[model samples]
Target: MAPPLVSLRVVLLYLRVLTVAFLVITVIILSTNSVTIVSQGNSMKFHFKDVYAYRYMFSAAIIGLFYAVIQLFFTISELATRTKNPFNYQLDFYGDKIISYLVATGSAAGFGVTKDLKDTFLALVVLDSTDPVDKLFSRGYASAKNKKLSKHQSP
Candidate 1:
């Protein structure tokens, strides 16, 4: 028997939960960092010397948090609609990946601009490691090669 079709409402609800979770986490982290930065004063020597640097960092964090939340929503929506809608499913994976990359890149750029070298470096690393097309193509090529070898061996 075929698996039961998933509901879009269920998916949307899940997305909503995920978005809330992300927001909560982001807020917690930002608040913690803010407190720490304020408390440490000049004791915590950050790379960014200008007052504008702090503004940039806060802005970047908020933007990154929002981006992450939105991405999660899209992913949930995609999964929810996938069985009933193959086209939407196809778009979701690529679209989410692209959006994620953009968010990461933007966050990193913001960090760089804000002189948060550590954050910038980490973002760059993450962006470098994720290549959906390369992974998909390589897996396909390997599977095809394996199938060809198996066919020859059977004959």
Candidate 2:
């Protein structure tokens, strides 16, 4: 006479586990695999700690991991006890919103870094193409940003 609440709960539990796993994987990737290149006797490297964006990525991943653990605890308690608390829905809603905000901020920061780094590396491959490539990138990026700004400003 009712919905499959147990099945729903089980599915949600699995989903939380999957989310934690994904965040852990992202943290690992961001923490390791820093890019290093030797130009002349000097070397340049891109590391998570050196970039704010990568730091955001790491922070988001860690925060998400902790949130997932807390969620798992509440969800497990609910399932085992077969009890529903009025606060669970509100708690879940707020938790989700907090996680979403963190993830979005991290994603935007990561995107900016990714675009700049990708262009820089590509230009590096051409050797001595930096100034011209940078000028071109400046124009293109400026135009794109202007368009985005204008759109956002419009009614």
Name the best candidate (by lDDT). Answer: 2
Residues 1-155 of candidate 1: C-alpha lDDT, one tens digit per residue: 23433454454446545544543443343333321122213322222223343344335435545654564565565455554356645554564455445434433443444344434534553332324323322332332222222110000
Stretches of candidate 1 exceeding 4 Å from the true structure? 4-20, 35-83, 103-155
Give candidate 1's TM-score: 0.33
Per-residue error for 90 in candidate 1, Å, reads 4.2
In the order shown, the candidates' Cα RMSDs to the true structure are 16.0, 9.2
Error of 2 at 103 (Å): 1.0
Clash pairs, candidate 1, are: none
What lDDT score belongs to each candidate, Candidate 1 first? Answer: 0.39, 0.61
Cα displacement (angstroms), candidate 1, residue 98, comes to: 1.9
The TM-scores, one per candidate, come to 0.33, 0.73
